[model samples]
Target chain A: MNAALSWLESLLVLAGLLSPLMLPMLYFLLYRPKRRDGLASPIDSLDARAARPSFFQRWHCGLKVACLLATCFLFISPRGLAVCLADVAIALLATALSRPSWRRVLARLAAMSGFLTMLLLMLPFSGAVQAGEPTYSLAFLPDSLPLRLSGLGAATLIILKATAVALLMEPMLSTATLADTLHGFRQLGVPASLTQMLLLCHRYIFVFQHEAARMWRGMRLRGFVAGANAASLFAIGNFLGMLFVRSFERTQRVYEAMLCRGFTGEMPRAAAPPMTARDALKALFWLALAVSPLVTEMYFADFMRFLGE
Target chain B: MHISDGVLPISVSVAAYVAAGAGVAVSLRFLRPEDLPKIAVVTSAFFVASLISVPMGPTSVHLLLPGIVGILLGPAAFLSIAVGLILQCFLFQFGGITALGVNALMMGVPALVCAGLFRWLQNGDRRRAMCSGALVGGLGTALAACFLALFLATAGENFFAAAKLALVAHAPVVILEAVVTAAMTGFLFRVKPELLCLPPRSKWRGKGDCSL
Candidate 1:
């Protein structure tokens, strides 16, 4: 009976270690089936959602970007687990209040699973082993594979902080159109050339994505399969070459058209509306909320000490 | 392979942001106003190309294309990469908002280095240029992996293992990028040789191909 229990524990630990490697397979098997109908444009759906007015939508784009990004930085600050949890709770509340599509938020989190899983698998064993630092060893496993508790705690903190910032992204970006958000960056002193490039690049990504899908389908019809081989890589290379050729030709025509429509060296910028007192108040509220977790972690040592222990 | 938020210490993240900003400023110093739209359009194509996933055993890896972008765009590759990364962050959340600086530096620095290497080595004929492209493509991925490992190591002693793992994972990708970039270069040489000759920004008249 004792041996059986030890074997079970070893299997559990092994499973925990290997699960992350299985995630990509599972993700493809479950989620990829729904995406067969060509590439769906995320921008159209996001723009439609942004058309709806909400509390976050009312804030000036420049101020909104600054405040939310500040919150994200604060979320990642070193703190106890309780403070991390509070940061996550605040992020979730902000996300909910902003009224974004639940599906998109979940998708954002899913995109992060790969990197986080890597950290989860490697950090525990890789941490510097110190004297008296707690470690977990399993029966039927190599003695060298000691999972450090301190490393586990560090990983957990990273995971929580990463999740919080990722959740906050939907509320920060989806509340405004891409162009408007970029315009906000311009107002915040980002170079105009860079902002223009972002806007123009974004506008054309959908077009090129469609072009690429069509080319891919055509390649498939010609018996070109994408596999782990030189032949597949060669075919993909040809496909990309053709894509670049076509895009370069199209750019000349596009530029000519723009010139015909009175294109100057610079794109015209729309003047931003004056900020109001309510916008300031909302910004202050969010800023304070962002700061609360750090304050609690730093000042209320007695309250946070128990959670740390 | 992009770094996510909260993975790096705040100080490292801030320092990366500053370094990446300086890189962009240097790239932008040679910018031509009239070429803005062209660069933007090319950037879209680069973005789309990166979305393509090539199958590996059991799993797959997406193309980084830093070498190709560098070879094609020359001095503008850094700026183009920075823009592409920002779009990836907002649209797909591939890299975190705060970690954007780190991601850009990881990819963009290699692109610049590969571009310079290709320009120096490419000579003689189409076959030689293709060989140079293959060399630079593999080198670009290798360099990016090194940067990633170096950045992760900055977090603490605990992350040293993760850093090593990240480097090893890119080994296969380096080979894959090499083959694809070579094939693409060969195709371009056959189809439109003019694209291979990216003229210096000051000398480009923006109307016709440079002397080939």
Candidate 2:
């Protein structure tokens, strides 16, 4: 039993860490594609007594930040990249080849390849990327901290690292989260007021983004050039002010509209289904996978030693 | 630049996470649903803003805007900064997953201080407000270095020595942070003058000053 458990542990580690690329690829294919409509999604179903998609049905939030957090949990896990990628490629290829028609295979290939390319671009720009630098090591420490204060400090350190990772993962996940807000959270049984708020926010986000971009272009055209070296940042700041003003005014009308429709802090209902057992399992599985690194390094001597802590 | 797993002592890293978490929780207390989008915009702005880098010395360091966030969001500044910091860690590997908290506080607290100080600045001279943002931006970077130093010191006894060495390592970086922050402040003044405004004085008269 012990030997079998050990093998299972090894497999879990590999699944969690070694194959980062594999999971993302699978997720992209399976995600039922986002919002086939725009932010004001033309009032869903348009039938009396049918559920409407609360104001911002067609918009995406910044939930990518949340997905990235889950991704980091994978990065921390110990696994074999080559094996994972090869396995995933095989899965994709199998799916493609098994298709009854040539057109479907080509479409699949194009989609997969396009996705792979975006990840390739996103990585360099991702804040999570670490540059090569010398790291502090803890090899020469005594087995136990010297006293209670040492233990206190030990507790402090763990909190610090967790905060760092949480902070880093939050924004990235927020984007994916933004994208998946209504569908994902609705499944989670989030409050309607909260959902309505997020939907509204998501809908208007592009307005801010557009304002920011326009201000940026305007500033550049005016020679307020902060600098690619940094002279350009002034424009970015000034743009923020403009973005805020427009967003603020737009928000007032939205609030009034909601109030008129009996939106007493509670959002109108959408026909989102409840969470299923499959989603529960999927959530737990991913949670485990995300925290697998700490688990692996904590429990497995071999992996811990391999990581050279 | 945020250190990750295996980069720092486990004890120091964990402590940072806890403290930063507490700080974030405090911020959440005053949070309103409406603040989410503003926070998101600020979060995206901070994340994208760093992509524009400035060359200093042999290497380059991007802007750290915890101060600016603090100036804009006050104590709630932590949420905006945390979101941006988390995204950076995951996607770009700007910092380590393990070191997220310490980084946040190092940056977050300073921004908070700057936000408060910006308010106290001569009752809303736009230039003073920008200066406050500038100071917060630079101060946050400097404080982060100190927090990092303190974090290293607790890594073990040898880290005390390492902290000394690390202080020297951060000196030039601090100067650069100040320069960029100051430059950013000056730029913000010319481009976005509204962020420096203290929410129409009526905001402070309210019970809680929280945003998402």
Q: For candidate 2, lDDT tens digit of each residue in A1-309?
A: 001124455456334322325533564576433421111111111012112232112112323223334444443333333323332333243233222222222222332232223222222222211244222212232322211223323332332333334333222222232325444544434334334434444344445545555655666577663433444334444444455445545655666676677765545445434545654554455455455545554578586587886
Q: What lDDT score goes with residue B122 in model 1? A: 60
| Cα lDDT tens digits for candidate 1, A1-309 | 012226688688767755544644655555553543223333433444776688888789889988898888888877789889998899999889889887667667777878988898788878668977767776775667777778878888888898899888877888887678777787778888898888899889888988988988888888877779889889889989999999999998999999998988677767767789988999999998888877866778787677788
For all predictions in the order shown, the interface RMSD in Å is: 1.7, 11.1
User: lDDT (0-100) at residue A115 of candidate 1?
Assistant: 90
Q: After superposition, how far is residue A271 of candidate 2 from its true place, in Å?
A: 6.4
Tell me the deviation in Å of residue A203 in model 1.
0.9
lDDT of 2 by residue, B1-212 (tens): 45444335556656777888777667655777555545555555555445444445455555666666666676677766766665555334455656678778767777777777766662435566556556666677677667766765564553454455555666665655555555555554455445444555523334323343
Clashes of each: 0, 84
TM-score, every prediction: 0.92, 0.51
Q: How well is candidate 1 docked (DockQ)?
A: 0.69
